[model samples]
Target: MVTILNEQAEVDVTPLPRGGDGLWLSHADMTRATGFELKSEGLCRGEICVPVPKGRHDFARDDAIDIAGFWRYLGHPVAHDASRSVWALGTGAGTRRQALASLEAPDFTLPDLDGRPHALSDYRGRKVFLVSWASW
Candidate 1:
């Protein structure tokens, strides 16, 4: 079994076929984990479909799709541990670029040094400077 970190939730999928570095999920698992289904048009989430690139044989096999590769193909980022059993999928580059262009920071809550929770949107109209750092 592997856990996929998508958006703000974690989806666990089982019955996975092994032997590849990329994550391969069954068609049903794909829909269950990501809500996207492979169709004649392409991978469809509701009415929106992204047509698969031509001449790409790596994305699909007998009964599985390479989700990690597909995410990369969609210009998104996929981060995982050395074991490749845990994966985190990020939004596509276009979506991220649009967010930056809007000039509005995405709402998120974080803890201050004193452990008080603070959300960026809490000071919507006020000027606030944010400093974040980590020591490795």
Candidate 2:
């Protein structure tokens, strides 16, 4: 999800419904929903085209995008009031963020190659190291 810090608090965003004529989404939702696509390619869901920076599609793990700038470019608004000190993300039509369908982590219990039940959280307080190699 998109994370932003303002004078008052932090804001988290989630995805919105389809068929709505606006651009409103969380960072995670935007990444997944938009298939990790950025603006320059102009290929987006719902047949929408936005003009993004030339190399935005090549974003790396450490890269950051200005959410407010992106929103404004996509016809959305990053709204804020001096009194509230809160920033409200708005779609073109004044739509607010959507309710998250589920926030629970995915079930990851599974058996390893040796048929042993492996629970990720089992090592919560311990240090674990994973190593992998390819013979290619």
lDDT measured at residue 93 in model 2 versus the true structure, 0 to 100: 43
Per-residue CA lDDT of model 2 for 21-110, tens digit only, reads 333454454554333345455435456655455576332122333444555665655665553233455556432222223533322466
Cα lDDT of model 2 overall?
0.47
- The alpha-carbon RMSD values of the candidates against the true structure, listed in the order shown, are 4.3, 16.6
lDDT of 1 by residue, 9-123 (tens): 7999874666667888898988887888988888899887978655566776667888888888778889998877788988887988888899887778877789898889999
Where does candidate 1 clash, by residue pair? none
**Total residue pair clashes for candidate 2:** 1
**Best-matching candidate per lDDT:** 1
lDDT against the true structure, each candidate:
0.82, 0.47
Q: Which sections of candidate 1 miss by over 4 Å?
A: 53-55, 100-136
